[model samples]
Target: MFVILVYDTAVERNPKVLKTCRKYLHWTQRSHFQGELSTAQYRALMAALDGVIDPEHDSIVAYTTRSPDLVESTTLGLPLGGPGEIL
Candidate 1:
C-alpha cells in the first residue's frame, strides 16, 4: 500500500509525531509524509501515533491507495523538508 500522511500538532509535540511518522514513511515536507507501507505497517504507524497525539487538539490525516502510481503530486517551490521531491 502507498500512504500519504499529514499531521498538525502542538509545537511541543512535533518531535514525537515527526519521529513516529519517519519510522514508516518518507517525510515529504513540513508535516507531510508519503511512501509505501504494508497493511501491518500502516496499522502500526497509526498505533504509534495514537500515543503521541492529543485527539482534541491534534489532527492526523492519511490517504491510502493500492499503489504509489495511483497518486500524482506537484511541488511548486523549493522542497521544504524530507528527502526532497521524488522526481
Candidate 2:
C-alpha cells in the first residue's frame, strides 16, 4: 500500500515521532511523510508512532491507497514528485 502520514506532536516527543517515521517512510515535507509499505509494515509503523505520541496532545493522520498506482497528487509551488513517486 501507499501511505501518506502526517503528524502534529507535542514539542517534547516530536523528535521521537519523526525519527520513528523516517525508518519506514520518506520525509516529504515538514511533519509529513510518504512511502509504500506492506500491511505488516504499515501496522508496525502505526504501532511505533503510537508508542511515541501522547494521545491527548498529539495527532497523527494516515492516508492510504491500495497501491502506488492508485495514488495521485499535485503541488503548486515546488513539486514534490511525479505520479508513482512518493508524494
Candidate 3:
C-alpha cells in the first residue's frame, strides 16, 4: 500500500522528525512524503513515530492507500481525519 505521512513541528525540530520519516519513506516535497510498504512496514513506521513524537506540540498524520489518494482526495474536497487538515 501507499502512504502519505503529513507532519508538523517546530521548524528547528522538523529536521529530526523528517530524517526519521525519510528512513522509511520517500521525500516527495519539502514537507510531504510518500512510500509503498507492507502492513509490517507501516506498523513499524508508526511505532517509531510514537516513541519520537511529542504530542504536546508535534503532530503526525499517516494516511495510507493502494494508490496516490493523498493528492486526489485533497483536490476532491474530501475530509482528512487527523490532527489537522492539509486543505
Candidate 4:
C-alpha cells in the first residue's frame, strides 16, 4: 500500500514531521511522500505521529492504496476542529 500526506504552509510547517515520516515513507518530493507498507505498518506509523502534528496552522493528510493513484485521486480537506484534533 501507499500513503500520501499533504500539508498547508500558512498554519504550521515542521521539518521534524517530514523527518519522522521518512522512517516509514520514501521522500518522493517536496511536501509529498510515498511508500509501500503493510496495513499494520501504516497504522503504527500514523499512531506514532498522532501527537507530533501542529494543527493550528499545519495538517497531515494520510491516504492508503494498493495502486499508484495518489496523483490522480488525492483531494485536500479543510482542517477542522482544533490543533489537537488533527489526528
Candidate 5:
C-alpha cells in the first residue's frame, strides 16, 4: 500500500511525530510524508503515531491507496527525493 501522511501537533509533540513518521516514510515537506508499506507496516506506523499524538489536540491525515498511479504529484519548486529520503 502507498500512504501519504501529514500531521499537525502540539508544539511540544511535533518532534516526536516527525521522528516517528520518518521511520517509515519520506519527509516531503514541513509536515508531510509519503511511502509504501505493507498492511502490517501501516498499522504499526499508526500505532506508533498514536503513542505520540494528543487525539484531542493533534490532527493527522493519511491518504492511502493500493497503487501509486491512483495519485499524481507535482512539484513547483525544488523536488524532494524518493519515498524514504529526508529533505
Candidate 6:
C-alpha cells in the first residue's frame, strides 16, 4: 500500500514518533511522511507508532491506497524535505 502519514505529537514524545515514522516512510516535511509499504509493513508501522504515542495527546492520520498511481497532489510552493506526493 501507498501511505501518507502525518503526526502531531506532544513535545516530550516527538522524537520517538519521528524516529518510528522514518523507519517506515520517507519524511517529506515537518510532521509529515509518505512512502510505500506492504500490508504487513503498514500494520507494523501503526503498531510501532501506537507504542510511542499517547492517544490523549498525540494525533496521527494515514491516507492509503493500493497503489501510488491512485493518488495525486499539487505543491503550491517549494517542496519541503522533498516532494510531498507519491508520484
lDDT of 4 by residue, 1-87 (tens): 877766444323356676677788865455566777888988888776666776576667887778765446433453222233331
Off by over 4 Å in 3: 67-87
Which ten-residue region of model 2 has the weakest summed lDDT? 78-87
Q: Is candidate 4 or candidate 5 better by lDDT?
A: 5
List TM-score per model, in order: 0.89, 0.87, 0.70, 0.63, 0.88, 0.89
Clashing pairs in 6: none
**Can you list the residue pairs that collide in candidate 2?**
none
Rank order by TM-score, top first? 6, 1, 5, 2, 3, 4
Candidate 5: 10-residue stretch with minimal lDDT: 78-87
- Measured by TM-score, how close is model 6 to the native structure? 0.89
lDDT of 6 by residue, 41-60 (tens): 99999999999999998999
| Local error of candidate 2 at residue 84 (angstroms) | 22
What C-alpha lDDT, on a 0 to 100 scale, does residue 64 get in candidate 3?
87
Model 1 residue pairs with clashes = none
Looking at model 5, the pairs that clash are none
Give the clash total for candidate 5. Answer: 0
Summarize candidate 3's per-residue lDDT along 1-87 as a digit string, tens digits.
Answer: 899888877676677777788888976555667788888998998898887778888888988887655456343343333334222
lDDT of each: 0.88, 0.86, 0.74, 0.64, 0.87, 0.88
Candidate 1 C-alpha error for residue 84, in Å? 8.9
* lDDT against true structure, model 2: 0.86
Q: What shift in Å separates residue 85 of candidate 3 from its native position after superposition?
A: 22
C-alpha RMSD between model 1 and the true structure: 3.8
